[model samples]
Target: MLNIADTLHGWCRAARPFALATVVGTRGSAPLPVGTSVAVDEDGTAVGSISGGCVEGAVYELCRQVLHDRGAPQRAWFGYSDDDAFAVGLTCGGELDVLVQRVDPGTQPHLAAALDETVQGGPAAVAQVVDGPDELLGRTLCVLGDTDSAHGTLDGGPADRVVAAQAGALLRAGRTARVEVGGDADTCPERLSVLVHVHASRPRMLIFGAVDFAAALSQAGSFLGYRVTVCDARPVFATEARFPYADEVVVDWPHRYLERTEVDARTAVCVLTHDAKFDIPLLRLALGLPVGYVGAMGSRRTHDERLRLLTEAGVTEERLARLRSPIGLDLGARTPEETAISITAEIVAHTNRGTGLPLSHLSGPIHRDRALVS
Candidate 1:
């Protein structure tokens, strides 16, 4: 989805007027989600996208019309069935409801500030209803950062609060949920149909031990859209000059780094520092936490020795089981780059509950990765 705030920022900088088109609801296999947005400037330039090249042309024409009429923000719907429904229509046979709002030049600062705060605070969710009765239309509420407090509101009193609370809960789940509020549930003080959009931030993959393998693994992690961090106790190896593409390079002890940075189920930890002194403490620390993937590189003999050492160091057999001793899949990867791919594949498989079999020999959706789901 296009970042509406960026488009607005450009409009303000260029002193241009634009119309923002946002998806408010969907009935079937909609290409875009509720919060998907697009902006069209007075000069007919477009930033972002609303659909999968299905209704953009029609939306553009609507944008032009709104620009000419200087009309108030209004709700619009698009589908494939109507003969007059625009030449471009959804191929998936789904229907979409959208909101088209004219950018008010005066409110650029307020909108820009909100956008900046939201982006800086990381993945978050914001909900607004642009269509409907005068009493409930064009109302917006946003949960800034990772906190629960919201800015802006709908006119529906307790109903607005109910919707805001729902949005916050969805944001915490890191997934968008379709909710019907203001119905039989007394929780919704008023009766209204609302759509909730939750944007979850990317997960962090912090790779400890800046070795040759770390560089390759970092590249693989980037392909997976993880915020990759490469670290090592040795400054000489951990320098950015070595792994320039890494999101971050920390020249500190592995355990020390984990102590300062937050590591949760969404986080992954890799111990490539094969040395006993380095691997032992780092693995112990990582195993103690609820990190999604904790891997250390070693051979069968190496793993056995490491296990003995770890057991001596007070790590339990259950914790040792958590450590994917050999690391990566059974792909028999040899080179650094290939090994990195195998390692990343193993991580994806572990998270996705995969049997790690070739899909050509299996059935069902091959791309059943939860990372994609989230």
Candidate 2:
């Protein structure tokens, strides 16, 4: 699986035979998401996890069986059980459908190419037939979504084209899901059902400021799984040594850098440079883009002035509403690190549609089902 790309790549290159067990479906409070997986080598060595630990031991044996007997593309089900400690299931009140398949250089000629593309940090996806005809059970397809390039075939069947295109589309949008094709879902037992796992690069977090706050924010953003980039026109302040956590420290005008760089719906922009000259020009462009989050750090008076200027510069009221001025929650943070936490918390809340209210003040499920990411 793409999750353990390095280990898989190493096994593939060394011509090591292995079996891959993937979590393809889940219900209730699953500890891990759908694409979580574990790879077991010929020696019974495992590389990853599906359940936190509850189901790993059972799945480990499944992988070993797949390798020894080659009677695979096996599907196994595990569920929560409090009545029996010896039961091979999750203890976390969740159920999972796991599929284990054998992988080697011979049967899967694409074993190396798929791992290479993913390990190199390109946008790639792997689609495997989880439910379908016997012959199509372990059929897998690998796609480099951005380039419209693919590495494997899901059998030389007509269903191959369908899953390939869908896999590429999912990879481009950075989504993972189970899809059905080739037959009506209500009736046909032979209908092709594929589970796609995408390995897209980390989303970008553009922090436009070179202050100490930016350094702290860069660290916070990186810990939150963002590829942080710190940008400022001031070369001395924007040095990589200053913002150690930023993936890139750019010495360019903030507005100019944003215009030339790539940004998408998953990108987050933080305007920490409160100066009017840099703030106005850069924010005018960022507000119009299809980015995920846009926030600015400033006092109440600065926010009022910035709003008036952006309005005069023709940023509509609707677009202006998208900006989070006087950035972060009302955490009353007094230090740079604390402010970074406040800001990152707001970003997470916004992204996940979470109420800013403390959990103790509300009552319901602690976590909601996430929407299919794009």
Candidate 3:
């Protein structure tokens, strides 16, 4: 799928066929999220991972079978089996369903073009049938950004249009989801049931400072799969050479830039400019937004003063409570790189609803089950 688009695009350009294995469903402690894919060339070259190293060997062989068989797409289930130790399964006591589909560049040119577009940093979503009729297996429908027109088809009927609309919604939210379709004439023409996987664009991370800490945080954000933007009013400080990892470097007032930028529940905003002039107006605007994480960099006294100023400036305590004043977790970080880790860790914990407690003190599933199998 989209996760391995770069590798597949290379094969597509060379007219080499490949078998794509995508993890479409999960249960228990699935290591990889759904939409994670592995693509194998005709000669057994593989790109990407499904269950880390747990079931990759088996999946590689399955890829070869799918390419040669080239029949309907095949779905393989992997999970722990106490019945037989020799059986190929996950050791993490998790279950995953992988859908293997063969793609020929000459036959599926539209799909190849879609991969090309995605690899070139275009905004879109591709809904592929992972659970459905055998005839519809491996079928895909791509919904380009803000476009009513779609690139491919599922049944070349009403079902295709329905799935395209669903994919477009999830695409705007930057989410990968399992979409169900098919019913009576009110929905689909037939009672054929189908499930599709919709992969979306990356979330945005806006760093409202061009300070040394902002430079390091941009790198960490990019590594965590966020499209990072470093912004500042000073053009000299917000140059691309300073924050090479950032997707964008904007020279604009923090508050003004934030007002003009688009944000969502997936967006993260970090304010590293501790100066009151920059902090007050910016934090006032940021705290009221629907962004996932909002953090401000400052000392204890500075945090108190900033909060008082925000409260006087008409920011409610409820909105102020949403801000992570003083930024970062208490990791005793002295350097910018270490501070960046602390800040990003807090962001992940906030997004996942995780307690900032040590793992040794908590006795339960390492990962929340709800976080998986989505």
The candidate that wins on TM-score is: 2
lDDT of each: 0.74, 0.86, 0.84
Question: What would the TM-scores of all predictions be?
Answer: 0.72, 0.89, 0.85
Clashing pairs in 2: none
lDDT of candidate 2 over 1-374, digit per residue (tens)? 67788999899888899999998888777778887899999987899988888888889988998999977589998997777633587777778899898887666767577788788887888888888888888788888747655578875756666777778877766778878777743333357778888888789999999999999999999999999999999987889889889999999999999999999888999999999999999999999999999999999999999999999999999999999989999898989999999999999999879999999998755555555422
> Cα deviation in Å at residue 303, candidate 2?
2.7
Task: Using TM-score as the measure, name the better of candidate 1 and candidate 3.
Answer: 3
Question: Native-vs-model 2 lDDT?
Answer: 0.86
Q: Per-residue error at 13 for model 2, in Å?
A: 1.9
TM-score for predicted model 2 compared with the true structure: 0.89
Give per-residue CA lDDT, model 3, range 147-229, as digits (tens): 64678788888887788777777777676777777866755654443333444567899998899999999999999999999
Off by over 4 Å in 2: 85-87, 155-158, 184-191, 356-369, 372-374
Clashing pairs in 1: none
lDDT score, residue 115, model 3? 77
Best by lDDT: 2
Candidate 3 global CA lDDT score: 0.84
